[model samples]
Target: MSTTTIDRYRFETGIYRPPSEGGSASLLLRYTRNCPWNHCTFCSMYKTEKFQLRPVADIKSDIDAMAAVVDDLKAISMDIGQNGTITRDAAVSLIGKVPALNYHEGFAMLFHWLLSGARNAFLQDANSLIMKTGDLVDALHYLRSTFPSINRVTTYARSRTLVQKSPEELTAIRKAGLDRLHLGLETGDNELLKKIKKGVTAKGHIKGGKKAMVAGFQVSEYWMPGLGGREMTGVHAAHTARVLNEINPDYIRSRPFRTIPGTPLHAQVNRGEVQMLRPHEQLLELKNMIGALDVTSRVCFDHAMNNWRHPRSGLLFTHDYEGYKFPEEKQKVLELIEAGLNAGNPVSGAG
Candidate 1:
């Protein structure tokens, strides 16, 4: 039988690839069509598209489609192989065992296992926080009901949007099974925030971040080094570290700033209004920023976008011994890049 097929995954166009912090996987649902404040100079999430929200019904349909397939699996018992590794021939042979078999369910069961680690699910498409809290809660409830085995649920949120929401609203959201909130804090320097058109003041980030913490939600605040350029690197590092100290979120993530074509920051570069720091300079800035970190937040260098891709590459990541951690091992990465640049290699920043 020939059945129509629909692709289930979707995402925005950007130079970004998922960072490996803690090895968490990403899945895209695309609730927010584009960044609400799309003027971030160094960003390319929705550079060519107008910002908007995907309709709730459309989102519901996507979930329903997946659920429908899962429902089919509940109707019959497929054969179980050793360690649950059902080979294709075995799966087909098992499907033949059922009186009335479902191809959709068989395919979906394999996909479900692949997506959720056969354990938890990850939803994505930039900022799902743009969804109304009630709508999001309903969706979360639906997913939990459907999967029943999803251990943790998570999503991305903007500081400004989070700040605009009432604490009560956020608490209710927390109760709805949102285990983690990823906030792209880029840089907490007020000047850097303004320049990026982040639309949230440094204070706003702290306010919203604190609210999430108050609601018992784990918060990951992500930032980018090299965003301050040459002129304000010190101020940017110092201020960002200071802000993180105040927010003291569960995770402080670093994304090394890189140039992407068609972004506003690229234009700034052309006009000489922005300066992309050298690899060594960026490491110095990171060092300053890390040195200034008086707070006890766990620093993460997990993402592929980070200058330091190795989680335990050097002193920064292994500083639990002496109780001194800075850039955790980013200087080692910086030194490698600096050598490349000196040797006349293109030396683009790590992703």
Candidate 2:
């Protein structure tokens, strides 16, 4: 067998991606570095690191390098007479040729994405929409052309950035192959929005979300359930439902709040400035929000943080990604929340 070349297998990867994308075998691509906004009280991601937009040329190089690995892997498969299929044996053989791959952080993720049919891709670190429109469009074009198998490409975007982008520029990027956007709305109450330093108003969230939909991008908006603590929970629920109703996004996901130790919100909890909700209190807030929700969006409690369970079946609300189709299932979801409220088992944040 020929010596397996491994240099072209190198490509950069970022630390974060949404759970749905991560679980569904999406190819991870780093188009930008770190969070541009970095100031959210609840978020700890990219706090130490500064944001840098990768040049278009460098991004193209990453795409090429990833393609090079694919080509080399297929070559290995063909050399081993496996008819060009990416097999475990071929991967093992390549690793034998390049021992350093055993320590590569992204190698397993890349290989698994390939094996799972490479249909979805997620752009990483924080927000990709902060990139200059032309650069982003060019990168998306190059990526889509390079990996013809990828049908959906998504990235985290901030509502402020989306509101800042011109409609035409957003349209062009959507046409350039960026299919979906995952936005962190956090909370929609004006006061909570200020408290968290999310940098976007409730009005801005509605505008940005509606704009993304208008520009032909599927938008998944995430809101934190316990974001407002006890004092603000009622307003948080009411206003969040209000903003989401205004946007009517394609998907609405509940990411219940848990403060990471280093984040500012964690400090607030330590200081007794913010009172975290009790287990069942979280569901009561959800009941308020879900009851008021009036949208065509898919409502999801997809994250493990929504831990209140029904006494009979265990694990209330089926935190599955697709979740319940709303309007039709709204009553059912309210009933589940009621069940959780009545049940004696305390809410557990464990998966």
Candidate 3:
């Protein structure tokens, strides 16, 4: 391959995405640079970085560069006995030829994504909807056209941004091929919401989530279980359940509160101001939330933070991405929580 062709394989990627995207499973397509809302007390992600929206032209160029990587990989495959199949030998051969790929940030991610059937992708950094509607739509169109193998394109979004966007603009972006939104609804209690500086209220969470649903985006709402601690746990669970019931999103994920070291919440925890929940207490809180919940959404304890012991299995909850389907599996989930509560305190708290 020519030097120009080798250079064509360069692209930009950011550091974070949802766990369900799988390690090296989805291409890290950067639409924005960092977290636009970096004020969350509990968050340490993108704290030292500033947020920036890349130009649509630059974004499209990144897409083209990514496509060049795939094309070259396929070419290498064709040259080998694999006949265009993306294989280990082809990737090894490409790396051998272009040794610079060893130092490329997005190289391993892109190659593994192709190996995984290239069916899914996650837009990187924090929020993508903060971009101008026309620009977002243009980029989405270019992306959909460029990688037709990618059916699911998900992104992290602030609830406030969704509320600020016009209905028509959201519909336009949705129609342009953006599929799902992962919203961080840490807690629905007004006090905790304000304490975290989440930048959106319980009322606002419902409105933004409903708007996204109306605009044809599959919504995945995440809530932190012990965010309020013992003082506010009851209200937190009840109100969070109420909000989720109102939104009835496609997914309701549990991200148990883990105080990150450089974060404001960690300082609070150290100061004895914000107490973390014990394992059993966390389970009881989950029961309260699950009991109050009335939605058709999938309730997931997909993160390691949901650490508690089960009598039979090692973990209290299954770390399945598509968690227990609500309404049908609600009873089963409650029973599991009871089991965890009854089972001894040999378990550990992730937070």
Assess every candidate by TM-score: 0.76, 0.97, 0.97
Candidate 2, 1-351: lDDT as tens digits: 334445567788888998789853798899999989899998888999999999999889988988877887899999999999988988898888877778777788888889999899999989999999999999999999999999999999999999999999999999999999999998889999998999999999999999999999999999998889999999999999999999999999989889899899999999999999887888889899999999999999888787788888978888787899989999999999888989966575621
Q: Candidate 2's C-alpha lDDT?
A: 0.89
Q: By TM-score, highest first, what's the ranking?
A: 3, 2, 1
Please give the distance, in angstroms, between residue 114's alpha carbon in candidate 1 and its true position after superposition: 3.6
Worst 10 residues of 1 by lDDT: 8-17
Ten-residue region with minimum lDDT total, candidate 3: 1-10
Q: Estimate the lDDT of model 1.
A: 0.63
Candidate 1 lDDT tens digits, 1-351: 112322331122222323431232433344456566777777778667776776666666666655543443333324343334424444344345532335332343344353445454445556777678888777777667765766777777888878888888788877877778888898888988888888889999889889888988888888888887898888889989888988888777777787778888778887989877876577668778876776656676665444332322332232221222334544553454344334432333542
Task: Identify the runs in model 1 with alpha carbons over 4 angstroms from their true place.
Answer: 5-27, 71-116, 308-351
Better of 1 and 3 by lDDT: 3
lDDT of 3: 0.89
Per-residue accuracy of model 3 over 86-189 as CA lDDT, tens digit each? 88899899888888888888889898888888988898879999999999999999998999999899999988999999999999999999999999998888
Count of backbone clashes, every candidate in sequence? 11, 0, 0
